[model samples]
Target: MGLSHRSAQSHDHWFVTERDELHRSDAIELNGRSALNAAGIDIDDVVYLDLYSCFPSAVQVAVNALGLPLLDPDRPLTVTGGLTFGGGPGNNYGTHALATMTETLRKDPGAVGMVTSNGMFLTKHAVALYSTTPPRDEFRVTSPQLAVNARPRRVPTEHYSGTVQLETFTVRHDQQGLPERAIIVGRTGDGARTWSRSSDQGLMAALETEDLLGHSMRMADGHVEEISAVSREGLF
Candidate 1:
């Protein structure tokens, strides 16, 4: 399947419209159920469904999109400790989820759990089922023959303009392996773009004192120029 979040205002409308048409309900349950149905599967066979919740919106969209009962005292959602409490470690976090679900299923052999992985700033999705008595489910393995050609969506590439969300970004380190500069993946009214600012002094300062992760830096002209400089490698 596909796990995607509303990152672009343009895509949001398309997503909702298409999702409702395909699923028949603007709800997470319906979306999940619809996918299973598309594959000609039944929901009763699904013993568990874990809403891939990273942000509040994800949870909200699932609830609204699927026509699921808001308050189900019996079916309490959420398996992996919420994203805030339990770190959303990039790609491999879901691997942990699979292992955890495997153990859970091992304990209760008949139980089936659906594990969904949301990747790339919630831009993609994948769902897998776990059961002790498996090998019965038919599968269409994704293959290169599918011939999927993905190109970055059309983004406005004029002089720096428009507003964009910062998905996940990082700083690059120099030869000595020190944080030398920061490169950010930003989305504008157009699409996703990359920007970086380099200054050994500024980076040294941030490294020596402040932890740079999750720090926001605006794009002005081009580079995120540093103001104060201490030494070439060190910062004031």
Candidate 2:
């Protein structure tokens, strides 16, 4: 399945969007679940899945939303390996995924396949279910955004400075595949979200060594410092 730019504003090259304001994981899950329901199939009936793998979290979020096992031997997440190994091909990656899924389903008639597509940093999502066997009802498309739009939104701080709690983050790598920098999304004491980047080699290495999804840190003068994970005892 393919997903196009939702609006002219989202047509830009930015990582964030101005639409429903749903988290990528929530948006993906909504679209995926709706698609399965429209196709009159359950998640367990899907024999194949081609999840959009722009990043590890993109796939992880979808998996979590779909309630699928992280590592299923019989139903591995990808049919074309993934974005990197399968060739990202920019916005056309989903096309390749659909083509791959079609071929696989043809090999095993009556087997159902699901393909997911993402646009612009997971801002837009689309999922398509296919099978050799016809559905009990005619195929239909559902809009998950309607439900997502009703949820509350977390306002982001543009010029945030001070202590913050990490919500989620991703580490960038150099051409040689070594850790280079980190892009972090954090929440301030007031619940405002902020995005910051850190290039400190030592800090980046430490981040790679541990799971710091809820870690806290301080930002000052465009530098992220004082990295520490949240303790179970409610201490930082």
Q: Of the candidates shown, which would achieve the greatest lDDT relative to the real structure?
A: 2
- What lDDT score is found at residue 175 in candidate 1? 95
Q: Candidate 2: misplaced stretches above 4 Å?
A: 1-24, 170-182, 197-205, 208-212, 219-225, 228-236
- The window of 10 residues in a row where model 2 has the poorest summed lDDT is 4-13
State in Å the error of residue 100, model 2: 2.5
Candidate lDDT scores, in order, read: 0.45, 0.70
What lDDT does candidate 2 reach at residue 86? 88
- Give the backbone clash total of model 1: 13
Each prediction's number of clashing residue pairs: 13, 0
Question: Root-mean-square deviation of each candidate, in angstroms?
Answer: 12.1, 5.4
Best by TM-score: 2
